[model samples]
Target chain A: MTNAIETTNLTRRYGKTTALANLNLSVAQGSIYGFIGPNGAGKTTTLRLLAGLLEPSSGEIRLLNQKLSGSGTEAQRLVGYMPDFFGVYDDLRVWEYLDFFARCYGLDHARRRTTVEQLLDLVDLTPRRNDFVQNLSRGMQQRLCLAHALVHDPPILLLDEPASGLDPRARVELRELLRTLREMGKTIVLSSHILSELAEICTEIGIIDCGQMIVSGSVDAVRQQLQGGSHLRIRILGAVEPAVEALQNTPAASRLPAIAEVRVDSSDERVLHVELANATEETQAALLTHLVTSGILVSEYHAQTENLENLFLRLTEVMS
Target chain B: MKNVQFISLQPNPIIIKELRIRMRGIRPYAILTIFLIALVAAGYGMYHLMLRQALFGGSMLSFQVGQGLFSGLALCEICLIVFLAPAMTSGAISSEREQLTYEMLLATPLRPASILWGKLVAALSYIFLLIFAAVPVFSVVLMFGGIAPWDLLKVFLLLLITAITCGTIGLFCSSLLRRTSQATVISYSAILVLIGSTMMAGSLWSYFSGPIWQPVPPELLYLNPFSALISIVTVTPATSTDFFFGGDVFGLPLLSQFAAGVVHYGPNGPVVLPIYRATIVFYLILTVALYWISTHLVLPRRRWIPRWSDVTFAVLLAVLIGGTWLTHDWWRVLPPPSI
Candidate 1:
C-alpha cells in the first residue's frame, strides 16, 4: 500500500539539543498508526514537523507523495493537525470558530456554511453550535478543535497526544470517531506516551525512545518479533505437585520436547506456570494429553496473554 | 483551477474576525463617546477663552477665534491619535501569542503578509471612526469663517496617515516582542522619540547654527507629525508668499527671525517644501517598510536570504525616498490662483 506520510532522515535541533534525530517514518494509507514513546521523546516535535509548523533542521517530509517544500501549503492542504495543547478563542461561538478556519482555507460563503454544519454534526457538537467556544467543557472543546482541523477536509490527520487529557468516556468516544474516520479512508497518525491507550485501536504501532523508532509493524507481528517464546498457565484439578513432577521427568531423548521450566503460582499453589521453548497448537495439545493420560487431571491449560504495557516496558529497558 | 486562484485574492479572514470581536463589545462605544465628549469640551473652552479675550481687549476678531478653535481641535486630535493608535494595535500579534492562538493561525495556509495587513486594517479602521466622529466639532470652526474646507480635509488626512503609521509601528513592535505590555511600552517609546526628540534636536540645531537667516533643514522634522499639523494650521495664502520669501516661521512668530528658513537649494534656487507634505511622504514610506518587516517577523519559517522581489522592493524604496529628497519642491502646492 502507498504511504500517506513519509519522512526521510528527519532531524530537528534547538541549539545543541536535538529534539528529533535522523529518523525515517512511513505511515500507510487508511491505517491508524500510533507513535508510542516516553515524555520528551520527540513525539510532539515529530508531529509538528510533519504538520509543517516547524522546519526540520535537516531532512525531508512528503505527504501523499508530494514533497513538502516552500511554505508547504500544497502538502499542508492534505493533512490536518490537532496540537496536544491548544486554546479556543474567547467570545467566538462554536460554529463561528469552524467558519473562521473554513474561511482561512478560502472556502466560499455557501460552502463554509455547509462545511461548518457538517463538522458540527460530525463532532456531535450541533447542540452547542451557538454556544461560546470558551464556555464548552474540556472534552467538547477538544472535539471542537478536531472539527477545526477537519474544516479543510484533509485526507490525513496528525494528532499529538489526542487522548491525553480526555476522560475515559471521552477517550472511548474519540476512538470510535477515529474508527469512523478510518472507515471513510483517512489515514491517521497519533502520538501517546501510554501504550494501552493506542494498543487496542491502533492498526500499527511504532515504539520510539530517545528520538528513534525501536520497532513498528502490525500488532501481532511486533509482539511475535519481540517475544521469542511463549508462556503458559496450567491449573491441575488436584494438587499441582504431581503434574509438575511429570512435566519435568519427561526424557530428554523422547520425541516430545522437554519443558523449559515449571513453577507453582505464588498466590495459588494449585496452578503451575510453565515456560515452553517453542509453542504450536499440536505441541500444546500433546502436552495437554500427556498430563491427562498420566492420571494427572488437568483442569485448565492456556498460553498467558502479554499486554503491550509489558512489551513497552521491556523494550525501553533493553534500550536504556 | 481558476476559481482557486481567484479565492486567494479575497479579503483576509483575520480582518473579519478581528473586526467582529472589536465591534461586538461595549468598550469601543464607551471609548468613542468619551473621545467625542473630550473634543467638544475642549472646543467649548477654547471658544469661551476667545470670547473673554475679545471682550477684555477688543482685539481678537471672529476669524482669529475660528483659527484658534481649529488649532486647538487639531492639536487635541493629534494628541489622541498619538496616545491611542499604538495602544489599539500594539497587542494585535502579541496577544495572539499570549492566548496560544498564534500557532494555529500560522499552521493555516494564510500568508504572513495577509495576517499583518488584516490586523493593520482592522485596528486603523476604528481609529478612522474616531477621527470621523469628531467631524461635527471640527465643522464648528467653519461657522466662524477662518478655517477652509480644504484645510479641514488636509487635517483629517494627516490624522488618518498618522494613525496608519503609528499602527504599523505598534504592529512591528508586537511582532518583535512576545508580550503585549512590552510591545506597547516599546511602541510608545518609539513614538515619543519620533515626536519629542526630533523637535528638541531641531530646536537645538537651530539654536547652535547661530544665524537668524540660516534655514533649519526640513529633514529633522519630517518624522514629527505634530510639526506637520502645526505647519498646516499656520500656513495660509496670505502668509505663504512671505513664507517663501523668508518672512516669518509660520506659527512661531517670535522666533521667526531666528528660524526664518527651511529653504532647499534646488535647481531653481531656494525651494520651500512644506513640512506637512514632507511628513506625509516620509510616513507613507515608513508605514510600508514597517509593515514589510512585521510580516517577515510573523512568518513561521522566514527565509533569511533576500529574494529577488525583496531586493527590488528595497531598490524601489531607496529611489522613491532619494528622488523625493532631491526634488523637494515637486510636491509644492501652488498658491490657489490669486483671487
Candidate 2:
C-alpha cells in the first residue's frame, strides 16, 4: 500500500542550527501516527514541512506518492493541516470563520454551507455558532480549529500539537474527535508530548529526539522492546517469610525448570512480588507445585501491564 | 483549458477579509483619527485665512477650499500616509507568523502570488480608505477659489503612490522580520532612505557641480519619485490653469481689495503651475515596481526567504553608508604639499 506521507533524506537548517537532519519518515495510509518529542525536537518542523509551510533546504517529500513541489497544488488539495498555534480573527463569529475557510477551499455555495454546518455539529460548535472565536473556551477554540482543518474534507490531516494547552476534559474531547476521524479512514499525523494521549489513540508511534527518530512501532512492540524482564506479583494470605522460605527451599520457585532468571521486588508479611526472565508455563507449574507441597498459600498472580509512560521513558532515556 | 477555467477568483475574497481586519481594531482607528483631526483643523485654518483676506483686506482675494495650499500640510499628509502604510503591511506576514496562519494559508491550494497579492492590495486599500476619509476637507477648497479639478486629481494620485510604495516596503520588511515592531521600524527607515536618500545625493551632487555643470542633466533630479512629482506639477501651468475661473469665486475680488495683496506682495509671488501628466506616469510605474518586488520575493519556490535577504541588504547598506562618509571629500582639501 502507498504511504500517506513519504520523505527521502529531508534536511533543513537555520543558520548554524540544523532543525531537521537527513530525516526520513513514512506514514502509512489509514493509520494514526503519534509523533512524540520534547521541545526543539523538530516535530513541529516536520509537520510544517509536510504541510508545505516551509521549503526544504534539500531532499524531497511525497504526499500520496505525488512529488511535493510548487506545482503540487493538487496534492495540497488533498491535505488538511492545523498549525501549533493558529490565529482566528477573534472577532469573527464561529460559523463565519468556518464559512470563510470553506469559501477559501473553493467549495460551492450550497455545499459550503452544508459542509460548514456539518463540521460545526461534528465539532459541537453549532450552539455557539454566532459567538466570536475569542469568546470560546480554549478547548472549543481547538475543536473549531479542527473543524476548520476538516472543512475541506481532505484525505490526510497533519495536526501540530492540537491538544496543547487544553484542559483535561477538552483533551479528552479532542482525543474522542480524533478517534472518530480515525474511524472514518482518514490518515492522521499528529505530534504531542502527552504520551498517554498518543498511546490511547495512535495505531503507530514514532519517538523523535533532536531531529532524529529513535524508535517507531506499534504500542505492544514498543512495550516489549522496553520490557527488561518478566515481572510477576503475588499476594498471599499467610505469613510472607514462611512463603518466601518455602519458595526458596522448593525447586519450583527458585530453581524451577524452563526459567532463565528471577528477581524479588519486595517481601511483605502477606505477599511476594518477583521478576522473572523467560519463565514458561512449565516453570510456573513447578513453582505452584512446590508451593502446594510446602503448604504455602498463594493469593493472586498476574503479569505487570506496562504503561506507555515506561516505554517512552525507556526510549528517551536510551537516547539521552 | 481545464486548469485555466477552474477555481476562478471571482470575488477576490481576501480584500474584504483584510479590510475588516484593518478597520476593526481600535488602535488603527485611533492613529487614523489623529491624522483626520489634523487635516480638518489645517483645512479649516486655511479656509479662514482666505476668508479674512477676502473680507477685510483690499487685495486680490482668491478663495476656494483646496486640499491644502502650504507644503507643511502636504508633508503631514505624506507622513500620515507613509506612517499608516507600515502599520498595515508590517502586520501582514508577522501576524501570520504569530498565529501560524501562514501555515494554514500555505496548506491551501492558493498560489503564493494570490496570498501575497491579497495582502498587498488589502494594505494599500486600507491606506486608500484613510486618504478617502479626508477627501471632504479637500473638496471644500473648491467653493471659494479658482481650484483646478485636475490638480486635485493629481494630489489624490500622489497619495495613492505614497501609500502603495511605502506599504509594499512595509510588507516586504514584514516578510523579512519575525518581529512586527522590528519590521515596522526597518520598513520605515528603508522608505525614508528611498525617498530622502536620492534628494540628499542630488543636493550634494548639485553642490559639487557648482554652476560649472549645473544643467548637465535636469533628469537626474527625477530619479527621486517625490522630486519628479513636485517638479512636474510646479513647473508647468498650461495644463492645470483654470483660465475661465482664474478670477476669484466672487469675481475680480471687488477691484478695491486687489491693492492690499498686490502692494504688499510683489509679482515675485509663486504662481500656480499647470498639472503635468508625466508625474502621474512616474508615480504609477514606481508604485507598480515596488508591488512587483513585494510579491516576487514571496514565491514559495524561491529558496530565499525574506528575512535573510533583508538582513544581508541591511548589512550591505551600512557598509555603503560608511564607505560614502569616509571617502567623500565634503570638506575642502588643502593643495598637495610639494608632491
Question: How far out, in Å, is residue A136 in model 1?
Answer: 0.7
Docking class of 2: acceptable
Local accuracy by lDDT, each model: 0.80, 0.67
- Tens-place lDDT per residue, model 2, B1-339, is 001112755555466567666677597789678878988786566556555655664243343333224222444466687677877888787777776667677677665556767888888876787788877756665664445667567667777776776777788788777778898889878877765666565545535775532321323333344443443223222122233122312222221121111111113432331212333344445555555565555555553445444564456555645554564443112211110
Worst 10 residues of 1 chain A by lDDT: A250-259
What is the per-residue lDDT of model 1 for residues A107-137, given as tens digits with 9 covering 90 to 100?
8887788889988998999999999998998
Give the range of the ten consecutive residues with the poorest summed lDDT in model 1 chain B. Answer: B243-252
- Considering just the first chain, candidate 2 attains a TM-score of 0.87
Interface RMSD of each: 3.7, 5.2
When only the first chain is scored, the TM-scores of the models are: 0.94, 0.87
Error of 2 at A39 (Å): 3.1
Q: After superposition, how far is residue B159 of candidate 1 from its true place, in Å?
A: 0.9
Write model 2 residue lDDT over A160-191, tens digit each, in one string. 99999999999999999998898887899999
In candidate 1, residue A239 scores what lDDT? 79
Kindly report which residue stretches of model 2 are placed more than 4 angstroms away from their true locations once superposed: A8-26, A55-60, A70-75, A245-269, A279-294, B1-6, B25-40, B51-58, B63-79, B133-136, B194-282, B299-301, B304-339
Please report the candidate that would top DockQ against the real structure. 2
